[model samples]
Every structure is written in structure tokens, then in C-alpha cells.
Target: MNSAANAHLINSESYVQKPFTLPNGIVIKNRLLKSAMSEALGTIDNVPTMKLATLYRRWAKGGVGLCVTGNVMIDARAIGEPGNVVLENDKHMSKLKLWAKAGTCNNTQLWMQINHPGKQVPKGLNKNSVAPSAIGFGPALTKFFEIPRELTENEILDIITRFATTASLAKEAGFTGVQIHGAHGYLVSQFLSPNHNQRTDQWGGSLENRMRFVREVYRSIREKVGEDFPIGIKLNSADFQKGGFTEEESIEVIKTLTDDGMALIEISGGTYESPVMALGSNIKESTYTREAYFLKFADTIRQETTASGLKIPLAVTGGFRTTTGMADALAHDNLDMVGIARPLAVDPDYPHKVLSGQAKTNPIRAISTGIKFVDDAALMEVAWYTRQLHRMGVGKNPKPNEGAISSLVKTLLTSGYKTFRTRRLRA
Candidate 1:
């Protein structure tokens, strides 16, 4: 074994040795969690494919304590992306169990992230998306998405029930938990954002009214799954876009969840309008350039909440890829867990590499700098190569030569009309 691997096995004490206990008493052995990343690997009918199972099995063996599946749409009409896994009925229970087994190979906890795309729905996928209000996603980015219809009061209630039903399915599928995708300007987030939820009904107008949907969803899940089942939420600390969900509103929402017995709260920010990809524009840049992306905001939330005597486990993710940096944030910043996304997508065994001393720090800079965000054609090519690396138990990194094959693979993967390709194609 290499020195790094040897060290990981021999070292009794390490920086990442800390564990986080969830509300249901489920304990995560380490702080590292694989944040949800959309792989677009599901079947056209929104079922889990063999390739999707293979992709997760590789990540399961990578050593992260927790792995959250990409957006599992609660409403079939409200799909986040074209190929997102949909979990609206019991028909997928067996397949989901298989997926759960593959994802939990290393005793790692696997959580399904439930979401509704709302007005952020891409035009090509669902031209008639739904939101709390008829407000568009601003004039600049309206071209990226279609005009969304405002959901009726009954429809909102039905959607909330759908979230609970999905959570129940997750429990039956043997998933460790379910994470409500309340961040990134999704359906739940649309209600949270003042800009998007401009309604005169009971579901809008004030922060409490806006938060009613999420609160009901959370409560319904608790009722269905029982008190001991873990239920997590990913929330935007702030929208970053003007006239949107602000830090003040976010803090209030956090407090409400804490009071209601949330298992964990993962803090993130940004929307389609002020996308986090706009380099150096928001606090995410501060995480890379300054350190602890939500350090200031988190501190304020923590101090005030602590002063008020509320103790909820808080997690922060975005631009985190260093052992020293993560350790510092956990120790000094009062954070309970750290979430990592793209890095693990590239290297599934990154957590093991870090723990075993094979790698001193997360290789975020190299991988992220190599990421070339381009048009759909370019992105498809990149996704193809990424799928290959994921199956081989290797992390994705931008390699120039892989682009040609990736381009071909992307077309094959996205062509919904094609029959299921054999697993050999993935290998």
C-alpha cells in the first residue's frame, strides 16, 4: 500500500474523525457527505437504471459518510431536469431498494433528495411549470425557462401530500432518510422567496405564510415516517438575488425548523438568476477566496439561535476541498458537518483518500478549474466522460481526448427513444 493508504489505516487520530448524530439517532461516522449532483442517468420514464445503480455503487465504496441522491421529483409534471428519477408511486419500490443497497455498500447513509422544479423548469422539458405565483424567473433568464402558471390552493396541498408520500416510499425503499430540496430556487424555495411568491392567498404575503408549505411537508413526513426516521432539508442561506429570499428570512426559517425538530439543515445559496457559477459574485467565492462561505452569516445565525437556546445541527457546503480548511471550519466555525459535491463526483474514493492519508487535501482546485461549462453539446460530452469515470471508480477530471467519445456517449445517453443499453456500454 502507498504511504497515504497505510497512514489512513494506521492513524488512530485524524481531523475528520468527528461524527454527527442526526435527529433520529443515525450517526454519520465522518463529516464528509456527497452532496446531490444531477447525473441525468435515470430512465426516460424516470426510473433508476442499471447504470445509475452502478454509478452509486462506485460512490458508495468511496468512503463518504453520507450520499444524497440527485433530485427525485415528487410531481411527474414538475421534473427538475429531463432524466431526473421520479418517485411518485409504489411501482419503483423494488428498483429503489436495489439502488439503496448499492449506495449503502460501505455502511454509508443514503438519502433521497425530493424536489419540485417550480418555475425554474427548463422550456424543453416542461413548458408549463407551476409556482406559488405567476411571477417569472426575471426577464433576463426567462428565455432559459418557460412562463410558469401559479398553482391553485388545492394543487399546493396535493404537492405537499406528494412530498410526504415520496418520503414514505423512501422509507420503504430502505433509504436511510429523505432530504427536502428546499434550496436552489426549487418549488419549496419559490414559496420562500418573496420575489417569486407574490400571492394574496394564505400561502403567501408573509414569511410565516410563505413557509407554511414546507412546514406542512415536514410535519406530514414526520407523521408518515414516524419520529425516529431522519428527515433533512437543504436550504438557501440567502438567495443572493435582489428582492429574493434574504438571510433574515432564511434565519427565521431555520429557527422554525429547529423548533419543529429537524434532523439536519444543510445551508447553501443562489438561484438561476444570480447563479453561483457567476465567478466571485457571492459568498460561495468567499468560501474559496475568503474561507467558510457562510462563516459570517452562519455565525450570526448560530450565536443568535444559541443565545435564544435552540440547538440544531448545521452544515455548510460549497467550495470546500481541504482538510485543514474543513477542520478549521468545523472546529472554529461551530459547524457540525461539511458537504462536498463536484469533488466526489470526480473522485468517489476521495473521503477514503483523505482519511487514509493518501491525499493531504481534497483536489478541488485542479478538478474545478478543469471544469469547462459550455453549451448543451459540450455539457453532454462532459457528462459522458464523467459517467465512464464514475463506473470505473475514478473521479471525473477534464481530459481533452475524452471529449470525442463523450460527445458520442451523450447522444446515446440522452436519446430517450433508444432501448436500455447493456451495462457493458457503461463499463
Candidate 2:
């Protein structure tokens, strides 16, 4: 198609597109966002590294509108995984500034995703991981995570403040926005999911109660940063595991967030038992078979928003590969943005390719990272790259753990590191 024709396909008024605007006036250069993918490259102290800078610089240059940093923990003790950058103090501001500058070099919006591990934290990292309630996720698959301790009401409030403080730090460090990581069975997702959150207090039991912590966190962040700073979240459309967070409940939560002034909401799903979002090698193959695995759920939410007259922008990730599919989704589905994680990892310039009409199909393959099953060679290769980025000062270094390679790979997958060669595998 010619430029003018393609422009019409993308938008009617012009053949060229403009930036996507969030509620708070934060404008992304385009509809593409590099979804948060954990690099596990932070320093031993969990500060950002030059390797992280390198990684983001590459992605920023690739042409995505926004690049979200992976898992910057709000509390040191509640880390989601080893090597996750902890954002508890102002001391790390310089490092964060470096990361932001590197990531936004191409005028891309850079958002740091703040989170807590809750029960998902490995026992090796903290034997007493805190949660909204004292509940084990399921059978102990690893020696790492023990039964987590329940957070006191005071602890909950402290965590809320921590989120706000972290957002303030991110803003100071030069981030364009902040994304609360509330998906994939982390602390915030744990509280949102009924199966994990079994508390009797105001923080649990009912859907409204389960959503209270996230609401408070959002309110606190808005209060600390004011309305101009963009705030977004990644939420599960459904947990997929039995008795966990469901589509029905997720819709309700999205509705609540829309009312609470969320600028963007990315739809995702699955948790430990299922691990859908991370592995991408599920037997169900939702994204492979069904384009945009979370579309049905997102459509329901969008319908709800339209019916109720809500205007928050929605970004859908997972199983979005083809440019035509993405364009069709934005034009027909009413979704404001498209999120590409693994494909962007393999080919960072994918968005530019799509927009320039060079590529029409998604480049992601079903190639397994082989780390999912704890392959030694695979683990070592991933560790080497992770450490290499750290050595290069792009991010922090994850502790080498052969058994935890699956989790490590999951983090990498979330960050967009899909292409690899066995020859590149090294410890």
C-alpha cells in the first residue's frame, strides 16, 4: 500500500499517525508500548545498571512509543524475584535517571513498573514474604517461598505509601509515567485475586474489598505526583487458575480503576499454577490460536466502559503479532493501544516496520526458551546475558540459580528477550 493509503488504513484524517494521549496529558508517540519485561540485571543492591540502559536504549531506538521497566520492587523484603531493582530509597535516583534517559533517548515514554512479590517471593530471598493474608500459593514447587506472613493493617498502609514514594522517585528520575504491576500473581494481583487473598478485614473477601489496596495505592500516587503525571497498571483479565481472579471480577476492578482516574490499563492474565503470561508455551496456546488472548475479556470491559460512559484508554498485550491484526484491533475494537512484548524483544524495530508497511505479520515464533524446564545449558546462557547486561551497566545482575532458571526465563520473557542461540548459552 502507498503511504497515503496506509495512512488512511491507520487513521482516516491522515496517512500519518499521531501520539496516543493518556488522561493526564501524557502523550505516547504512537500506539505501541514495550510491555514491562523483567531483565533481572539490577545491582546486588537492586539498583539499575548500564546493561539495563543498553537494553532500553536499543528498545527506545526500535520505535516503541513507551518502554516499561520490569519489576522495580517497592519493598526490599517483598521482592518478586532475585535481582529485581528495589526502589525503597532516594539513593538510587542517579541510576534510575540513567535508565530513564537511556530508555527515552528516542522520545519514547519510559514507565517504571512498581510491585511487591507477596507470596510469590522465593523463600530463599525472604522466608517471611508478606501478603494481604497468610496463604501459600499452592504446593511448594521450590525451596524458595515458604508460607508468607499476613501483612498487618499498618503494613498495608506502609506499602501504599511506599508505592507513592517510589512513584515520586521515578518522576524525579525522569520517567514519563509509572505502571503499577498488578498482574500475574504478584502482591497487588494477589490481593486482587480471591484465591490468594483470604483476609477477613477490609482488604479482602468481597471484590470491592479485594480491590481496595490498589485503589489506595493509585490515590496515594495521584496525591504524591498530581494529575499531570501519567499512572497506569497491568491487570489480569483472569487468573486462569481455579477460584482465582476471574474475568467477571477483573471487569469490576477495571471499572473501579476507570472511576479512580487510571490513565492506561493493560490487560493480561495467568499465575503460578498456569503461568500463561510468562511462559507463552501453554498447551492451550491462546494467543497462537486466538489472536490477542485477552481480547474477549478486554472487549467485555470495553463494552462496559462504553455503556457506562467511561473513557480510560485500554492497551491489550499477549498474542498480538500481525500489523493488520493490531491495526484492526485499534480501529475496530476501540482499543487505544497495542502492546508487543516477545516480538519486540526479538525485533525491536517491529513497530516501525509495521507502521512503514514493511511487515504485515507478527514475527514471534513458538520457539521455547528451553529454560522453562530448567535446562542447564539454557539457564547458563540466560544467566550469562543477564550478567553481561549487568557488567555492561545496563541493569542489575540476578544471582545464578540453576533451579530457578525457569523463573529467570519468565522474567526475561516478560522483558522481551525471546531470540537466543544454544551457542550463546553460557553461565
Assess each prediction's global lDDT (C-alpha) against the native: 0.74, 0.74
Those runs of model 1 whose alpha carbons end farther than 4 Å from true positions after fitting are 1-13, 277-289, 365-427
lDDT of 2 by residue, 244-348 (tens): 898888888888898889989998888766666654423345435456777777777878778778875899887777676676666555478888776665566
Clashing pairs in model 1, backbone N/Cα/C closer than 3 A: 4-357, 4-358, 8-356, 346-395, 346-396, 347-395
TM-score of 1: 0.85
The alpha-carbon deviation from the true structure for residue 334 of candidate 2, after best TM-score superposition, in angstroms, is 3.9
With candidate 1 superimposed using the best TM-score fit, by how many Å does residue 344's alpha carbon deviate from the native? 0.5
* Total clashing pairs in model 2: 26
